[model samples]
Target: MADPTPLSVFDDLRAESDELDDAVAELGPERWALQTPASGWTVAHQIAHLAWTDHSALLAVTDEDGFRELVEKALAAPDSFVDEGAEEGARMPPAELLARWREGRTALDQALRAAPPGARIPWYGPPMSAASMATARLMETWAHGLDVADALGVTRPPTDRLRHIARLGFRTRDFAHVVHQVPVPADPFRVELAGPSGELWVFGPEDAPQRVTGPALDFCLLVTQRANRADLALRAEGPDADRWLDIAQAFAGPPGTGRPAKGDAR
Candidate 1:
């Protein structure tokens, strides 16, 4: 699949955020306090993290120096910086947190839109284009939105927006292995997924010996570490591809302790 235009990605990012907002707009304080699957994180923390990241992204786009400060703080406490941001935001009243998220995301949108043509944005990972930054934001909003839904005992119907995530998961195939300290695959793997709307999404050459095929929802969940592999319907046709399924992570940073199968004790 071709890379989506930054404009389209920014639009989708807004829609994804709006959808998550609708899900929690009416939530009571008590519900916000409920813990999600992420350890030590409540439903509020999920939203807080999104808001915090959006703010950081804004800084990255419009104020590189400020963004670097955040980088220094993160480097100073690699293990605690993420949780620290989430924890600080999660401590606010539900109303305040929601307002901050909405406001911060709007500012980020404006900053990204105004970024000079051909300019690369500083990020936690390697510098990338504005479109890539937007895609990363969309990916995270959707993933954390899942945790919020689970906490609320509601199911978010799958949507074509997952295509962005599916593509990311495919492109990050090698990064996944490298992060795990495993050898990066010397050759690309072919990946085929059936999108939520029944569209075919194919990546890599058809003749590639390694292949992964599955429902797009399952692939996104696996790559995001939102669900256990044993619980997903994804199938792999090569040894390396199979191993990739075991450790595939679309996001940067340390690999997560993914969810356990339904049959396993938590």
Candidate 2:
């Protein structure tokens, strides 16, 4: 069978939502307030943010005027908008918040499916094609899902779905450099990851001198800022590749302070 298409990325998004929901389903109120690895955010805040974004994404597609108003409001209070939204959402009853999240994601899925092939949707970062928007949603779901998993001390087994994230990370290599005002590498780095199923997933030129080689899960985690790059067994073969690993981020925003290596926390 062929690999999933960009449009099919929504299947992966649904899978992530299901897995994360299942993981958090049985938590009591105390567990809801447990802090995640994302500083200043509890488990509830994580889900709340996802809920808000999914709803915002729906607005972006179906109601441009409302979405623009939202953008203006967000810009007016740039630094605190996201945190404030999540904090406000956390005030809902835990079950209510979960229901709202489920509903918002369901609506988002419907909106994306109904969107035309070439449609572009505005977002907090860049405006995105329908497929790109879906993939971004998937990436965020997986990244925050990791935080929720960690807070619960649960080890969620990785799946081949990480291939989507790894691909996004590699494609964003130049975005990573450009955002930091660093010069984009003239030559692209080859990326070869051993997929969870043991298939080789290769990106970039096989003959490229600069290369990143590792397990797909590790690369995904590294790009999402969920794992410390130093702790991962990934190898970089050239100066550009090495520097890319040090600053690679799959999500948009200012450069992130990545997680610390195990046993190295302050």
Each model's backbone clash number? 0, 0
**Model 1 misses residue 79 by how many Å?**
0.5
What lDDT tens digits, residue by residue, belong to model 1 across residues 162-207?
Answer: 9988898998988899889999888889999999888889999999
Query: Which residue pairs show backbone clashes in model 1?
Result: none
For candidate 1, give the lDDT of residue 51: 96
lDDT of 1: 0.93
For candidate 2, write residues 1-266 as lDDT tens digits. 24569656888888889999999888999999999999999999999999998988999999999999999999899788888889989999999999999999999988898898888898878789877888888889999999998899998898888888888999999999987788999997899999988989999888998999999999999999999987898999999899999999989877888999987956
Quote the positional error of residue 243 for candidate 2 in Å. Answer: 0.3
- Which residue pairs does candidate 2 place in steric collision? none
- TM-score between model 2 and native: 0.96
Q: Kindly provide the TM-score of model 1 when superposed on the true structure, using C-alpha atoms.
A: 0.98
List ranges where model 2 is wrong by over 4 Å.
Answer: 1-3
